[model samples]
Target chain A: MWRCLLLLCFATSAAAGKPDPQRQRELRSLLKNDCGACHGLTRKGGLGPPLLPEALAGKSDAELLRTIQEGRPGTAMPPWKPFVDADETLWLIEELLRKQPVSMEHGG
Target chain B: MIEINKSIDKSVPLLLLLLYLLGNVCLAELRGSGDLGVVIERERGSVLIIETSKRSILARVEKLGDLSHASVVFSRDQRYAYVFGRDGGLSKIDLLQDKLVRRVVQAGNSIGGAISQDGRFIAVANYQPGGVKIFTSDTLELVADIPAVYGDDKRSRVVGLVDAPGRQFVYSLFDAGEIWLLDMRDPSRIEIQKFSDIGRQPYDALLTPDGRYYLAGLFGESGLALLDLWHPEEGVKRILPEYGKDDEKLPVYKMPHMEGWSVTGNLAFVPAVGLHQVLVIDMLQWRLVKSIPVAGQPVFVMARPDGRQIWVNFAFPDNQQVQVIDVEDLSVSRTLQPGKGVLHMEFTPRGEEVWISVRDDNQILVYDTRSFQEMARLPAVSPSGIFFTSRAAKTGL
Candidate 1:
């Protein structure tokens, strides 16, 4: 029963999305090699929004591409007319929107 | 410009110097000066207001989504106010007209924001794909978008945002042990400083009046973390533990819910959920000096400007009243039963009264702090965050 309780705690924590070592590396790479040039990989955010999952969760693929293609009329998020092909941008947006594990561990 | 003719008097040379300085001061005073009021987000569809005082609501002009939620902020001089909308919409609300005259659709999400101390720029924290977008408060144009990576975990949110003096604005990512500060002096781009070694599940943070330290409240960590602004690389300089004792030793609430520092800049208070108490910390030493026990999962704690009392809102079991705490003695002063669903409280600048947002009851309860008496309850529609402007600084019925 004690083992079961421990397992239960672990399961809940994991479900809440504690950072996984493998996932972090993959996210960092995707952001750096792929999205970094435009959106910026590190502290320096650029023309595009950061690829953090919390920001992309509810945003739809079409909306993301629409923002890229049409460009916001009032702001500087210019239409990515010649920057990149539409399909490639769509694929990148999908990956950016994917949810990662929750990080609820009290490391302190 | 009027030219002042000063005759040279060799005998009273010192008096002439004083007159010259006085003339310059008078010329400077001729320039119009006004009080800066807190700009608040009013969830009235596409419309938001620049509230100068408690009762006065100035409609800000801006092009916004009919369904968009926007956060409004005013320049220090009360000349300009910026409105940030979710999904990259930005608008400038001109204070003089009390209307939003310029709109920038793709600026960034209007989730969290801080106005520059100089009132030249406004920084907004976009919720999705967390990033900070800086805009010129005067022109209402997109200056820069700094990619701000939040919690490694997805549930963490970039909720609380504030601009530290100088040009840097700090973004507090909830449930994440990190905060990102970006310099926005240059409108063309953004400069970033990622401080990831902060306490767990950091919520809101505020700088001391002297601007020496930035204190942040952490959830689940049971402590408040202090960061030295001069050295961002130093990480958390001090950790003040929050207090709570579970009589049953059974797990109920997860951690500390919401915390607020007093306007007096002396005490830091946290609502210890499930523990039924509010933790008080001395701001200077960063120590948990006392604990004032209270009823049921206390969700929110708010300090009046005088710093004498703290109003706490209990969440679970749906208690209708907000618990009061006396700062001097650190004891439970009185239990106030205002209305159902008393979740959040916003006080006027004078600290004369507090307006409590009762969600389910759909009303904002106005109360007198001195008598602990309920004054008048204004009907509201799903009020979550209650804010008052400098114009509406008095407790009204």
Candidate 2:
């Protein structure tokens, strides 16, 4: 069920491709600075659950997307729907799924 | 040729002794570390050793790993700071020399740590493996490990690890809704007093100024779990349990920090969970006296050293602004816009000045606590958590 939906979303997103470069940078910043506040900088988990590739290995795209949009109730995680749209949240999930989350960490 | 070589070797030792003594005399500058502090450069995995009096960054000590959620507690001597990193890296920095004295990766992931009353043992609260590990303050060697085992094969992440008087460590178990008191008077013999069913999801906590009460802010509910260290036998009491229960709760973007100088005199100011107000509690009765509205969700609602002013920094969407509350009338005295991403605020030892960390601007702004004027500005790289050496003398910093 989730597997089939994951395939469809991945196929569609692969064609749609990643967000623009500027939005990509903004999303990455939000991931490290905002999301990283609870989730560890390395995405190993702190106040929130870990977002490492290994942690989210089996989850489907829809489940992950809903969690980002609506957030998990009874936890510190908040819904980012006001700040980000569905498309941007999907790109963030991909960014976390990509190789080396810390590599994208930009410093001043 | 052999006799000449032997003579040169003997002379080398004598020459090195002279250079060693001379190097110590010239390089060792006699300066007190009482006014010094450190600002965490989160993105760069580094920290800046800052001097409060001059408002200058003395040195940038780099290569500290995973400082995304880093916290620091000073040694009793104020010469060293034990920084607990998100990656579970415990770094001891030498303030005088402005360098990383030693770095040790003790756990998989940790939030913060505390030093024992004697300053001999450093206890770290771990999140990943879920436990508390105590180490020798001087050598950073493992002395004791107590896992937060709440249920069958279930480990809870430890938060609010604070050292109280009588050489005891009080901390909260986040997942289990429990608080444990670890007695470390004798490092060999371990004793723990567990307070079960205290509250739900204690995100963070702080020990009071007099080191009497340990308050744990509840994220699962709208109350704070208070444990009086002087009378632990009485059990934990829930204070302000129903605050904002009927009110609308906005989605909390960032967790409110329960640790800091949030208490002063007869009153304590706490950030309401997911509400734009600061809950004022009377320390005498442990009751809610007033609820002062604020600009946004408060993160660090800290009081000045003199107890005259309360400075607050907000979380997420309104993170750019900081509001000051005049303690006399209990009102928002002034609001200052210190650029974007105002991460943290720290008062100097004397309360004459306060340092604010603006992350997006990459600048630390110092303001006069009395006049509310920007005194000085210094450059930093995405700074957070400005901790001063004065905390070394206080309990539960």
Candidate 3:
């Protein structure tokens, strides 16, 4: 019975595009700090291409996910697979698609 | 008849007083002098002129090319500002006239630049073609171009370009892992000194306030390479050996900026990349004495000009906060949440006030250093770096 429950938990998390609140928060920080370095803090373009919703409107979710995992060749953008997993990459794409601002907290 | 003449005399004086006040307002607008500074509008490719005394915005000049990573160095007279844009455009603007005097695209892509000690030449470090270009400060004309060649490749991104004493410029090459000194006292005959294999990847470097030592941060390794600029023949040596060697390396969200690293008295505060700590170094021994852990990954570890306290800001999840470290104890005295996206900070010349740029909030907040109380708030458009003309008189600014 314990094994069955454990399998069910794993299956649920393995589902594609499943939303996890804890993972979402971590991904938001990554997008705001890591990606935001080149892509402006406000998601406007900087040294790299802009990641705004309007800019990503034409690109599909699969395309965006692939780029995040594999990165663009011959550019400053490096593959983020080492840091973020596949599911988290999708979550980041959806966050970018929705144009959600990273909710920041006060000082620790 | 006597009453009508008295009324006319009073009305004439009132009209003259109004005219005099209007003239004074126009004159102040035209003069454009006083304690002045600039805020780099990163995405908009513009700079906003600010009156430091009034804590107000004077004007915004646009059309500075790809300013995603722009920096400015003022002329000796402090009347002109030389802006180095990321797209390799160097523009000289007259602050009094509020106009661009001259602009030239000198390279394919550039990072930051510095003005010579004599203020006669401006040197820009290029990333695309991988070299350093020197231009006449007055004309923006190319005086020398030295390619950062390593092995067989003729291109290596040059970073950490700073002007030193004796009409010389020193910089580090990222791809080549080298530090070079270029002497341009005689533009007709330039002298170059190359110190190769300084480290793995020197992302940024800074010179001491007294112009004695030049320290380069190695991104590809655990330690930093230091060069004694006063005695160039001694060569480069690694300091703080084995730093971060015992810990698992975390993904670096953004590179720690050595330009903002501060040295006060006998200690230097260095922001360690991928770590939530600021390494306090004993300058005399050139060794890491302690690591003060903070909120998150540290970006800029700037010291107050008075050398009493150090201010620190972080990256990503912790970027909204700023911390004050008391220099005497090497401990955090206070933590401040200035605003969202706290990008950069600059202090007044005398360390009376600190101006912080909140990019997401689009506001520049000035606080009294002693009380940490908000003194003024000026609207800005995604401001990043705040600079003052007072930096013009200081070395290694």
Candidate 4:
């Protein structure tokens, strides 16, 4: 019952939690710089594996979501949950999948 | 007979005129490659051959594959630049002709490379096949391939590959946490000396100015592994082991590159991971002396060529701000906001001026080192590494 309640709560937050345009820009920069620090600026893979759509094709959404939240322990991949909330992480992952600008007007 | 003689005389004059023009074209005023460099246009898969003396670009060579993480090593003569592209494309670019002379895809994924001490070989560190590939510097032909094989059929990613004095190449194995010295003095009789358990996850490393000590920065742990090239029997020793233990490990937005770590006298200024500070280490003792507060997590803590000042650029949000650390006082002397996405900075060969690449602004801003005045600006497409021919003479640039 608690798990279901939490899932519903998360769903509601995710539905209402589309980041503002400015926040979207910040997220984009983070994806380019912060994440790019390891995964590479073009997402071709450096110390970490590639985050490009083709690279992420084999990995499941759930797996990526968990990795971003909890972080890979042994590797250089740090837990980004402290900076990015669950809802934003999902949006960022979706942005990576789309491989397009995440601004509201351009998302379509 | 008179008509034929007239035709022959006219043809002889025309031939003489053509020869004179050809001779003039061949004997154009000679120039030098000392001030020439190649600026990487990371996003566009192209390179701009730039001249530092006049602060201008000579030519733009394109179609270098996947340059998102490109690194370059100049030929001994500095006339040619061997660019190591992210997608394993090794391109040899001629600065004088301004063309891609040769390109070879030797690996699946390569990080960076180094020119051998003798400049005869180019050794590349690979992440995919997890080994080092040595090529003949002249032809980019495959000469030797040393796999970082350890612990089962697992091959560790090679990082921190630098040529030590005398036909030697030293590098760190990322996955295996080991350092290996490759002796190619006798190319046919290859010898490898391995140092196991030298800390964890050495992301990158750099050799000292004199090429004596090679230090590898640990990402998995807080310490840096130090290896003295003079004495391999002593093995690798850990330094700055407790740096991270003091503070709660902040999220490292970007990994601090170890390539351009500044060493002025006995002091080495290194970017402390996951923090807004540059750790100053006493090279003589290989110990952390002090941590100077900065604008943000320093990316490249590079010293000026003359070793008077150290300029540091940060990571991500704070990357726009470059702080100058006075080596004498060990304090933050000044900060300059050189627009957004300040990716990399390179001081002129003699350290008179600096050229900074603002990726977001799409401009290379030249600044006078002393006055800190904007000297000139050149347009580019997402420029990253600004390498001068000066690196050709220096070891492990």
Q: Local distance difference test, per candidate? A: 0.55, 0.89, 0.81, 0.86
CA deviation > 4 Å runs, candidate 2: A1-19, A102-108, B1-28
**After superposition, which runs of candidate 3 have C-alpha atoms over 4 Å from their true positions?**
A1-108, B1-34
Q: Which stretch of 10 consecutive residues in model 4 chain B shows the poorest summed lDDT?
A: B244-253
Please write out the lDDT profile of model 1 over residues B1-397, one tens digit for every residue: 1233343344368887889999998876332214323222223323434232343333433334421233455566556555555545666655555565777665334454667766677677665556566777777676776655544435334645766656666666664667776666664556777776676666556555445566666654556667777787787654655244234321222222342434345677766534666767776666777767787656667778777887777743445778788877888888877766465676766678777766556666778889877777655543445444342212110
lDDT of 2 by residue, B1-397 (tens): 9999999999999999999999999887889999999999987889999998777889999889888879999998899998998889999999998889898999999989999889999999999799999999999999998999987879999998898999999999999999999998789998999999998999889899899999999999879999999999999999988788898789998998988888889898999989999988999999998888899999999999999999999999899999999888888989999999999999999799999999989999999988888999999988888999999888888
For candidate 2, give the lDDT.
0.89
Best by DockQ: 2
lDDT per residue, candidate 1, A1-108, as tens digits? 774464444334443553357755644443342343234323123334565777676875656666755566533244554544455455445556654311111100
Query: Which of the two candidates, 1 or 4, achieves a greater lDDT against the reference?
Result: 4
The residue pairs that clash in candidate 2, if any, are none
Could you tell me the lDDT of residue A105 within candidate 2?
51
DockQ metric, candidate 2: 0.49
Model 3, span B1-397: residue lDDT tens: 9999999998998989999999898777555353778888876778888877778887788777666567888888888888887777898887776778899998867888999999898999988678999998999889888999988976788988988888889999988899999988788999999999898878888888888888998877888999998889999999986999897655555667777539999888988866889999888999998999888888788989899989998876578899999999999999999988888888887788999999878899998989999999998877888887777766666
Q: Residue B388 of candidate 1: its Cα lDDT?
A: 41
* lDDT by residue (tens digit), candidate 4, B65-129: 77767889999998999999877889999999989899999888889999988899999999989
Clashing pairs in 3: none
TM-score of each: 0.61, 0.92, 0.80, 0.91
Docking class of 3: incorrect
How big a share of the true inter-chain contacts is recovered in candidate 3?
Answer: 0.11
